[model samples]
Target chain A: MAERKVTVTSEVGLHARPAATFVQTAAKAPFDVMIAKVDGPPVNAKSILAVLSLDVEQGDFIVVSAEGEGADELLDQLVEIVSAP
Target chain B: MGQVPTAPPPTLTGTGVSPGIGYGPARVLVLDVPEPEAGARHDGDARAERERAEWALEQVAADLEARGARVGGEAEQVLHAQAMMARDPELATRTGELIDRGVAAPRAVFAAFGTYRGLLAAAGGYLGERVADLDDVRDRVIALLTGRPLPGAAEFAAAGSGMGVTTPFVLVARDLAPADTALLSPDAVAAFVTEQGGPTSHTAILARSLGVPAVVGCTGATAIPPGVPLLVDGAGGSVRLSPPAHEVARARRVARAGRAVLPAVSSTQVSGSHLFRRGMTADGHAVPLLANIGGPRDVESALAYGAEGVGLFRTEFLFLGRAAAPSVAEQAEAYRAVFEAFPGDRVVVRTLDAGADKPLAFLPPSGVEPNPALGERGLRLLRRHRDVMNVQLAALAAAATKTSAKAQVMAPMVATAEEAEWFALACRTAGLASPGIMIEVPAAALRAADLIGAVDFLSIGTNDLTQYALAADRQVGSVAGLQDPWHPAVLDLVAATASAASGAGKGCGVCGEAAADPVLACVFVGMGVTSLSMAAPALPAVRAALIRHALAQCAAAASAARSARSAVDARAAAEAALSRT
Candidate 1:
């Protein structure tokens, strides 16, 4: 599994609109993607509710993991969204 | 429920909560979802069960999307978010996992949603509010599997698609749940008819705020046939079945003329418009008209109605339906949301008033008493759980620092001076400036002087006060007749509390259904109550009523009402006195 860690930069955090946008992007990929608060169990990245329930706020670090073809590309995109200020 | 087309349609009478006239085909709302039997296993084929769950989810998602499209605005956005929730991948995956474990599709869906509901509820703030939304989605999916009318299905279909009843309809129901009314299309609903509800029920309040005609507490309303055209006379509190065309036209003509006089008052308009003015009686006695809101979302309506301040900010939204009490930070954030809305204005917040009608699953009193209403509730529960009270006060105090809004903290169900004093000290300890006690119990009202001496202010909750004084369960339909704030006994209590507050030179306010009544509002002011807080929609009517009557006229009405023999006589006397003036 490919993994990357990114700090949430959106002021409203990784929930609400940001969470919806992240899940919409993750749902488009052919491979499975998961997101977790740093040192926390990963939840399905494609699930808006699950991503929101993570309660990831700005300045909080989250670990993104995925496995399969194009996993690295997916990780890069998700990490960019998370790290976007 | 069959439609009877008699020559002259029977006119069923009820209590009119909102005033308007409407005519349309009936759209019955079914909100109750039968509990899925426990331990029901799916057929051995996990794939088939998964297919069933997926189908139900897709149907619900499509319905939500269609409704969102129909009602374009903030409501549309909320519905779109609900659609995303309906199609949540985590929920689907969990349901599949449960099916794989031999659970039936319905039970699997229920259990899967339960996990997320608890998580969201426990989060306890913005996320906590979404738990109700998730429950709506869950109920819809389950209803699809069981082949039942989805809760609010009639209205959703009517508004969303052209296939269902395309015309606007009169919404009839036993009662409406928050989920059913949350995103309703005001244009699609002609009026509201419910089997049970008072002037203070959610249905009445929502109807009035939306400017839709509503008649509540109508016996046999649920039995009205679906799609039958009915004439609703909101002012008269009557629903006429299959009315003659001429009769409907006359009603419409009357409504049109009324609208001509009050151009700002319409079924779809909400702003206070021409009525937006400072709260004062005809003689310029300043009695600030305020709003009673459940959360920050309601602050807009309060402001739109020109509320001087928030008189009762019920904090139960933070605690209701949650697995645990909200953390101090979460509570502070919620409080701040409301506080920031009314800078420099008074925002009186009631500490969590749970028990009886509204019980927190987390706060359990020692064994259930046969009657929970009289059991541990309000200040009693908070006293037993002192930590909860302290944390809430601390949060309020912290939030007050962020905004210029004058935050006054109060305790509900305070029956004694000691309880009032205890709450007052607790507020001071938490650094909150103003501490108050709710005058809900008869004992508290009777001993208002003592309680007022112990607290900074007194706010009367006439709903519970009437119930306790009359010995009628507010929730029981059979006893709803007895739950009348107009009762001389209840009036006496209000007069007692008001005089006590006046004697002590402290502010007193009435924040309940009683104060919402335009005529009664004047009476409360006459009795020396300094302020009135009620649902935002009621503000305009109450203000107009107050402006029509002078201070002396109001005082005369109050005394005349007090001298009346019964609740009926009290209302009559007050009305007669006002009319004579």
Candidate 2:
């Protein structure tokens, strides 16, 4: 099991569409994916409720981690997604 | 309603904004102040305490004077007033009296603050009761506070707050707040005259919506007490007490004559040829300038301004100020009307963005409120209130088939790649075309390359982008300097979104303040923003600016603007481009 902290880059943050997006992407990944507010603990990314619990806004740094193949790339993509601009 | 209308009231002397005399009515108004509770204990110990409180206030006042001597303007006055409260002898004397009575420090301060504050408030209360003359209230107030009789109304504006009116009278007030505007019955009041309020203040918004003329920042406005003949020229931002008979006669004549001419634009001004031409830059470069309308009234306004199209049709207002959900049929009728109004123009309708700051009157505002800016609004609101979203979608889908106008639906406050997918899926299920998301969130910008693929077009809402970018409110003066569109952070975000959309051969436009700013117009145009939507009135200047600058010059201008520190700097850099060939 692994987790990497990342920021939410979308203008509105991770409360709405982005949170749902994270859940969808996390569900597609090979390993169990989780995201959390940087100041908080990791939670299931697939669950919209859990993802939103992160309260991630644009520029918020949070951690994303998953176990299994391509988890690193997944984290990288998630990071890119969070800190886009 | 009779006769070709005699000349409007003569040109009235009022305050000046940029400097100019304009004719308007004599709006006599009284001020409304919150009434304070009565009853209190007055004694010697209380006197000593009051002295102490006065001393404390003096100290604060001294401190403000010291600081104000160095810094001036609006900020100085703001700080100085606070200092004045601190220096006020009454505040010190009252507090001291309470403290001597064995009251705790906080309690003593509050108690003292209350008693003395109450005295002034009582006077204000008395003034409110009289509503016509404040001289009586002023004398009683000054005598009570300073133990000295006050002067006459010769220095009237200095005596007390100004008068207020709900009817068609020149309502002179020290300031106009939300409450003040609320008291103005449209039928009774012809216009608003305030000694204070910025162009962007709520008072201004409300006043404009009511079609009432307004003048702000009038000095010594309270001079014209209620009933004493005075003229209020809101257009000139001035007030004159007892204008000579000649000036009054001249005003009435000019007003009657001016009535024949369109004094100002109306809400439904989009009907004329002024809006007929494609809203483009002077140089032949086309930039769509759409209007973000609220409802029928705004639609009427948009059409009046000849808005190219409705970039954002906010659906939230429909759910608010109403008891129940607007049914699919009702919703369709409205949407159809909008589409019908602009047969060839595009109407990119945004789904209900009602949650957080904007709650649905008919439904439970998604209880998810810790951080509404980052919470369920826009698409999430739709998911939470699917029935509402479906009804809107169904309406739009049906309306689309019947109307001549093009309808492209957009979702707001979207944050992720998958959310775009959901929006796409939902739009498809509803049989709607050109479904997209508002890339107002930074995360959405990061996945822009992918997100744009999920939608047909992109419209970046820069207002929220700037807020989330610097974690600053648009209204806070202290942090206003940092709320720059040119900030590397913001520019980078906008650039990324633009780049992604461009790479995918998709269209992207910015429909925020920056888009409509004359100075930033070229910069945005350079950034490849397909359309720039702003307040309708801002169209001409922005159009003029765009026409002066070429597209090739725009890219470099954007880059130059990107390096600027604030909006001011960005504007300077953009303006610099116009100076050249």
Candidate 3:
């Protein structure tokens, strides 16, 4: 189990394209991706609306976590995708 | 269950399609399309190296074969019969042979496919005139290439009844693809609800046809899942899930039982309501009241609303907002079901109106302008996707023959008279009886006179016309006021379009939002429009308005409104005149 912290840096917030793209990327990977609000229980990474419903917008610090063989590597990539400012 | 059984509420409101009222228990049909496959990859060899090189070749043949299979049941043995080419063993074997030759799977598939397709075309003919066998061949080729027959909707049949209860209910979903939406049973389902679909989604159109009720674009539908004890009243666009016992009891109390139904009384026609008969002029000329139906659920509403017939039965809803296009036979079954619902009445179907305002991911995204009003859409999209249009028209034509209804095929977003002619010609070639055009573009309205001969009928789509005329963005809240159809300009366009149809003795109908308003019925009549088609619930008010008034008065009101300088002035004057009637 590993956790990666990244402040969502996509403009227009994580609700629209960024959120969808995030879910799509997460869903594409084999490992389970967990996304949550700054201080909330993580929701499934594949559900676009759920991720969006969390209301994690740009400039907000959010926690990304994963549990799998490549947890660290996967978290790094996920962080990279999320942390692009 | 009674020598004198009780009934449900005297009134039920829903997303009124085709404006009629049917006081029956909710028949909830949850239309659902199959979700995209779980496995997907971006920038990866989802396929092995052997399958990558000739992706083009294998893809094309596969596309055509899949297309053939998809088109199978749409209309007749003719159009979709072309889809049988998917099952063509030689085509498959040849393409497979190409792949075995080290040319790569994609190229081998595409290369062999290309040759076979050329043969089908050289011998079978082009889109409009292609023989049945050839068309199916093309469909199969495309279907195979696309991997799936374009992402569309389907049906969602609940596994079973819980609590030994067959209570009338309305089914709701996020959105239904065409395939799953097909599973919706007209007899069992009362209504439909969806959160993420537009007016053009197949589920919406099916709801309109089944005469069931549907409310789409609700968006938060996962919250309303299957097996939930829920109550939906489409007329009100509201749903009460797990209602209190009293509410269920109240709904049951208000429910009108017995599908056997009472026979029509001679007085029933004249006494109950005058809306179904298209409003009359003070002079007593009959006006057609057509229904602007989107899905099967709205069919019942359309009939109830006193719609003389369906005026704008959008066909594109079957394919839009999905992963891919629909097969011809798949489209045919849906079309047949709609036309069948309104037997003997006129059901004017517009070909798929995709692109601009509505886009499909499967198609290469043609660069859309910041404001799509000026971009390519409607007939332009049809021109580009001739394959889709051909199958749709063919399905409509086939469905018409099967349903025993007067199903006239038409085109959407016709900007030029030539476009009308081309669409009409496509319809005719497909064996559809009437090839008509929808007058949504200002250009069509301006040149209505020239466009009449090109079409069997003319339908005034006032909603878009007003938007375009006023340069208003329909989605923009600031410009909401400008979307008024009563604008003298929109009315004049209707009048002009009507006049054009009248001269040629072609059918003229207005199935836009303007037609649904009770106050505007008279004005539409006055404008020389042959019919006023609208959503079903508006029928009662529209019928009452028409019955209470006369055609001469409506014409007079239209004239005064038309003389107004602006849309605002025109609406004001029209409203005042309608109040008097």
| lDDT for residue B509 in candidate 3, whole number 0-100 | 82
State residue B364's C-alpha deviation in candidate 3, in Å.
3.3
lDDT per residue (tens digit) for residues B524-557 in model 3: 8777788777666555556666655667777778
Supply the DockQ value of model 1: 0.29
True contacts kept of each: 0.61, 0.00, 0.00
- Tell me the deviation in Å of residue B37 in model 2: 2.8
On a 0 to 100 scale, what is the lDDT of residue B581 in model 3? 35
Candidate 2 docking DockQ? 0.01
What is candidate 1's lDDT per residue for B70-122, written digit by digit as tens?
76644555677788988998899999999999999999998999998898888
Worst 10 residues of 1 chain B by lDDT: B262-271
Docking quality class, candidate 2:
incorrect
Off by over 4 Å in 1: A1-85, B1-12, B21-27, B31-147, B151-171, B177-191, B209-212, B224-231, B240-276, B327-330
- Model 3 captures what fraction of native contacts? 0.00
Residue by residue across B1-581, what tens digits does model 2's lDDT show? 01221322322333332211232344434333222223333454655645544554454456545544444433243334344345333344555655666553334554544443443334331111211222223222323343332322211221112233223454556565342243234444445556554443344444444444566655445444445455545445645556788986776676556543331322123234454335554446688878766555566666655578888776664564333467888888888878888888888888887655455434444353567666666787688778878888998899898987889999988888888998888898999978977888888887799898889999988777887787875433345556566676888788889899889998888876566567676777788878877655455556556655678788778888787777667667766865677
